[model samples]
Target: MEWKFVRLLSIGQIRPGMKLGKRIYNEEGLTLLAEGAELTVSIIRRLERLGIDILYIRDEVTDDIVLPEMVADETRREAVKQIRTVYRSMMNDKMGRMSYPHLGYSFRKMTESILDDLGSREDVLIMLGDIHTTDHYLYTHSFNVCLYTLTLGMAAGHSREDLFTLGMGSILHDIGKTRISPKVLLKPGRLTDEEFAEMKRHTELGFALLKDEPFVPLLAAHCAFQHHERLDGSGYPRGIRDGEIHDFAKWIAITDSYDAMTTNRVYRRGMLPHEAVDILYSGSCTQYDQRKLEVFRDKVALYPVGLTVRLSTGQTGVVTSVPPKTPNRPIVRVIEDEEGASVQPYEVDLSRHLSIMVSRIAEN
Candidate 1:
């Protein structure tokens, strides 16, 4: 039977035979339970041991609520795996056991998989920073940048062929970092001017590596070369001015910055999606192409569904739906009062109440 609503409950409140309304993921983004899995005594104990205190459950009262997934779990996992494959192949080639042809083929296959999984979707407002493990940061960030770049390109009315090139470029744009020393890449503190200069060479290095490879276009190479270039010529490498940057490079720069800001790194905690968007907007024209950045704002979910938030009125709720016109102001299902007491659930459409702004992300 299809459940019409979903409810969030404490781990103690979950009983055996209750079906999971949403997939439960650990802090590392590993799935613990999939939707529709009927909880048993052991499963409940397992979740408790893992310190999970809250989850979405399918039940009679909350059966009317439905939470939409940002992307298919299978598709995201496959993309990450393929990205890992490509990175490893590149590493092998760097070690002089070259396989240019195989590497090129793998890049093409990964791009095609990306298209098949995400291209036909109506919207691409996904959570890009979900998979965050220190060791696999490169692979995870590459996949996210690729996804975000593809979405921005599509929004600009780019053709599929153009998106194919854009996607490939965005994924491999940071490949040159592999050549840098781990001492610099993994450093927790600020880098010295010398170390910073060395870090900046990734752009040139990436361009040189991919420039003449078979099946890789010159445009893709430029994407690696120029993604760092800013509109005012303040960026690294060539420091080229506004009109000199390639269209693909310009778009990738915006997505790269967005993903980088919203992702947790060893040095600092990640910003929320809306917070990152605000920073991007502040940098428009000087650090990014303002025209492209505008399109980016429209496509991303500033207040993504399933996020718990506190309103200015002191009510807390889970985001229910993003109104079409105002992506920032969403309809929230308020479940708690100002003092943290559980209350009767009700919907609050932020778009309707101009004074009720979202305060911050609330803990589940």
Candidate 2:
């Protein structure tokens, strides 16, 4: 019988004869491993040297493993296309640039469709974990931030109309970046002081582009303007205090930072969901809204499905599911024992073990 279960394991966990269930790619758009290829120790070591973290492998023991996607692939593709259109149209010229009235209806229509689709789902955590075009990072990042903000809004019980507005603001929050010099914006290395200053102007530039448009709401424009503002008045352009910041801006701040940090750029790799949440928590109250940050924390998958983790009790397992009440604790399917011996697959509820904590994420 053919193996039906497929699990995403780190490169370190692969053994000879284990068949790849998915193709692997380098960040530069080259295929490194083909699907259905049996992994050998030498090939695995090459992947390690190349900085590959995880691989989908078909195994008899994990035949039932499944990882759920955050949104349908079709919907994401359409949204990205729409964003690219709006961006390209606006970047055509300074004076004769495409107007918002022309694009506002279509933009809202797309946002509504996205909301309609996401609203039908039961999962709260928004994971945009998919391979994307390295060249069109802005458009993809915009769509991701928009969806994430909408999910966070839903978790916070925003009304339907409110969700529509939030979605609109989020998708276009970084539109101003299109006006920035490509050299500084897409620089693979750290920015110089003046380049960094120029980069920070995206907030005001975006707001200026959208503020006068009749169809765009003032609230949406504010989201574009103040997304970088901090609770402790440390943010740029305005240096506004907590009370001075708008609600949607606060929400977008968290979403924007989270998405930016978790996406792979030319210079850095994407972080795991748990690791991203930890960074959000570290900046709570000082850099982000504390209450909103907590709401975000509870909604994300702390131990996302297919992630391998090591437990405090010296056990290692793959996270199978996240318990709603205790997101930090998940249902783990243990595959290795304390002595590092292969064991019969067994499930453990992490919440039940008061003393056991997730020590670290295991490299795939």
Candidate 3:
């Protein structure tokens, strides 16, 4: 029904039309859904009281979807964990003044290192098919923006200095949000004009904060200032049109918006990856740079490892690897049948098996 990252998922909230990922099941085949002590009617009522919706048991699943452990490196793994922690802290701090000193440099440098190998492709895909699902919301958006920016810069054949500049810009793009009021930031409803204006002031405020940083890059200031500026002058802080905003700034805005929309917000649920793409499609080249967005679709993996998704066969399965060039499709391991029938484990590659498609996206 919607998109949810594997990390925030609770077994107690399992529902129909949702898909399961490899992480859904543990080494012993017990799932988060099977963690609670009992599934009795009284227990269900207790779960509901606690804001839980449903529960699931590990069903029969295909095996090939799980990747061999060889590809995941320990150092990269540890770094990824740290990125998530910092991202959440920053998101919570967006309402007012907050301290997050090293995040920008760290995010920029780390992304640069990772993209070094993925850059220079015939195409500008910054991630491999096998590795691109980001779990944390804020940092993930930061990372996604940088990823797209870097790759686009490369495709446009910018120099190393320019590439690094793009990275810095993307990471700091939302720094202005640090000045918005808390209630308005997390309001579970649409923002009022006054509240929205308060939010808009963040762009100018974010720019002010970085104006004095001694070693900060120029685009970093622009990132905070111009990321929200639109090609048609519909963006905030200023009525800047096409020639006013830099190519790199525009790139970050497009990636940033797409990532933010597909992520879970307190007031609203995230759009499915495919759905997010469709929404972006309408604005591509108009609100966004068409070429860069297309390159983004190439690098970003919608069905990342350890996530559950639905199949066209009316079954649910977990995603393991990225499919070749087909970011829309991926390798999946079946876990359950349409009737919720128990089935054995098996793997299917959407790229190889064109007959099957990711008919819908279900949450973990």
Candidate 4:
């Protein structure tokens, strides 16, 4: 089989004739453009409007590197569609208590599908940060959070039943945001103190929406309530501290914060995985649980495959693989020399070359 080389490129760097190396999906999870489709001026404009920041493009240097997907594309489409449905209903209803008869049954079924998909994988490292659309941030963010939280739950040796509850809570953790006004919710600048105060209300708002629902689990509702509450009692809605919060909420909090930081938003560009992890570590034992942070750091691909990075030795390469035990050290395939010249590509295993380091992400 012939292997295609693919490079991750920001949308601004992509040219009109460049072939898309990956399929583009809309907010509904329907295919907006199939893989190998040619980009055009109008399509590019539309994608920019949708707030898509990055895309995979065919390249000649990086070879035989295929990105991993934790769930089937069909499963993701259905999950996103379901999330959009439920969240939209909650956002549109003035009473905030629309009696959706299938709420519990539907979500439970979706959770099972996600778990089953996750079970089939041997190693799961989140690579979903590569593609994001700010307009659809809530829906995709919910789904991504669920995936990350469930992965952490499984790593922590949770039972299947426990996993189900965790998944539900993580997926709906931000349901309260549905009630916030779009003006404040999607603001492109730093929020004022008044706006942030209103934003903090999502926790209570989420709890109020989920607590009385017939099929929604009480623990799941609390997960929404307490996911923002820090270990140091600095979190809002109740100022709850460690042991005061449930274990499930704690797990959701770690993944929730990770996803929010790594994902692109209208207000700012997303941080790289390593950078986000650093911030998480900075808050360890104060804002976050210590042991759980270790588990999450190990599972993450700090430098994901296809990311262009610069080495301290002044070479440039795309990450080929991240070692499971040493996520910080990845195998990189160098394609350029220090002088910004193309070279005969070769691989460098950072774990073996302990003296060398990845300096930073290569500039466009």
Candidate 5:
């Protein structure tokens, strides 16, 4: 189908590979197709041409994890609403005090279906970051992990089966945490030594829970067990060496860490997305898998909209969008002068202006 997010998504234009988004309210804005689904790359480029910065991805969005784009197409919203229902139920059955082994298989298959849909085009915005969060933090974290891992898996060219396995394992990596005590799980201060030890048991606990499922794929157990294991063998449960670690675990480790650190928690405020990228970069020689660490620099947004930032020239403003091929530095829409006085709106490409440096990226 000829893909376009025009006056609205034209019916004839909705084809198998064309990524879709629907404008929900003219004044209120847009949403993606649903949680866990990605927009095809072609759609992103077309939207870019229209001077549209936001194209909705189908996935769960959280209150804390802000989606920079507020407006989206309406057709995309309907598609995503159904997807949200499916994801909510799948996670509930798997994590809630319920037994639904059969649902696990369908849930995994659903992940693969979401991945193969690179839209009909090569480029699309897979909803990796825009997750909707509620009271269930651990479960929400698992869902986000699955969404992010699938995006990285496709980017790294993993086989179809491998991607499916990765998604399934990631979605459940934290299941063991559900078994931990609520006191330790929700503690506000730094974890005591004893509390830390108890918390660490989740890895082993997670492994035990997943190892024997009837439909569990090969290595699903290791994914839960070894996601915490590092290349340097400093990780918990068992400090297995890198060679002993499966490639699947390696991929999960990077994505898992990235997601965990960037997200907010009761114990600590989360790092900015760019700061999280720096952590992954620093951990490369030690804990993180080198290859997998790259996904952050490429995919994660450094300066999300509404975040305040300082420029090398002493000017400051809100981030607009990271210019193409220049993600490290973005074009900011200036809001104030260096002295904090109000200023007129203007755009500057930090990538093109060598004199302009990002002194620091500060989030409010």
Candidate 6:
């Protein structure tokens, strides 16, 4: 039988001539390298310089696992293009009074496209395998937040119009960051108290930028404004508690934190999905809405396909599939024996094998 798996490797584990299993995109959402392209030393160096440390590769043991796309490439590319254009324009016009000619229409259409794409999927899970450069982290992050927010909104039985509003708010939630200095915004290390205070101003600045815009909805502006607010009033800006916070902003808050923790940055590696979820749960009913957090956790693929994991039985395997109903328990294809010997591969469905458990993610 043909084994279906994809290997996730770090830059240090990659070598010349390995075929790429996924497409890499540039800041403009353009394809930097096509899928199945051979990697060379020079190519690897260039990717490293671009701050890409992880990649998915096809090999003898992992060749046929076709990961599903939550949104089409074209849709994501166009949305990123729009985000870059609008954000850069706002940054250049520091006065924040200039009008964007088609800001409202463009984002409305993009939100609709995302909703449609997500609706078409039989089972949607938040998978984190997309390739992007560090320089364009904001734009990519905006798109991802929008995806996660909308998915949760749909799961909560939100109306179509509500989903559009949530999408718009999530996508442009960080528009205020464009006004912040790159030095502080892109600092490679932890920010000092003073610097952090300055960074926190983005919420108010974003509100000022969007509140009066002709095309932007007032609720959407509040999403940017209050997304940082926590349940117990420890958050920023207004320091509002549960009822004071808008439902939309509360939703955005969960997605924003989840994505931030799970995405790579200049300073640190991204945490695995399960790790991030654990942090989220720790803040339940205090920092986040417990009901919303539970919904978000259910929609995330804790052990995404292509990830390497170790089972409690001391066997190692590559994740092949994740059932939406039981995302925590994925189907793993064992490739190594407990004694560290190479063995004929076999499939293990953790949902059925109740005695077996995923001990940890392998570091390979």
**Candidate that scores best on TM-score:** 6
Cα lDDT of model 5 by residue, 135-236, tens digit: 235544665576667767777788877877887788777767766777887675579999999999988877776787666665776788899998999998
Model 5: residues with Cα > 4 Å off, grouped in runs: 1-100, 113-135, 362-364
After superposition, which runs of candidate 6 have C-alpha atoms over 4 Å from their true positions? Answer: 1-5
RMSD of each: 5.0, 4.1, 7.7, 2.4, 11.4, 2.5
Worst 10 residues of 6 by lDDT: 1-10
Least accurate 10 contiguous residues by lDDT in model 5? 57-66
Taking the tens digit of each residue's C-alpha lDDT, what string does model 3 give over 37-73?
Answer: 3345554454444333222233323223333221123
lDDT of each: 0.76, 0.78, 0.59, 0.85, 0.59, 0.85
Q: Give the range of the ten consecutive residues with the poorest summed lDDT in model 3.
A: 22-31
What TM-score fits each model? 0.80, 0.86, 0.65, 0.93, 0.68, 0.94
Across 206-246, the per-residue lDDT of candidate 1 in tens digits comes to 88878888888779989999999999999979999899999
Using TM-score as the measure, name the better of candidate 4 and candidate 6. Answer: 6
| Candidate 3 Cα lDDT to native | 0.59
List where candidate 4 sits over 4 angstroms from the true fold.
1-5, 186-189
* Residue pairs that clash (backbone atoms under 3 angstroms), model 4: none
Off by over 4 Å in 1: 1-67, 92-99, 188-190, 338-340, 352-355
Question: How well is each residue in 46-118 modelled by candidate 2, as lDDT tens digits?
Answer: 7666545556787676667665656665677688777878776776666745356666677777788889878
Deviation in Å, model 4, residue 308 alpha carbon:
1.0
- Alpha-carbon lDDT of model 6: 0.85
Please report how far candidate 4 places residue 41 from its true position, in Å: 3.9
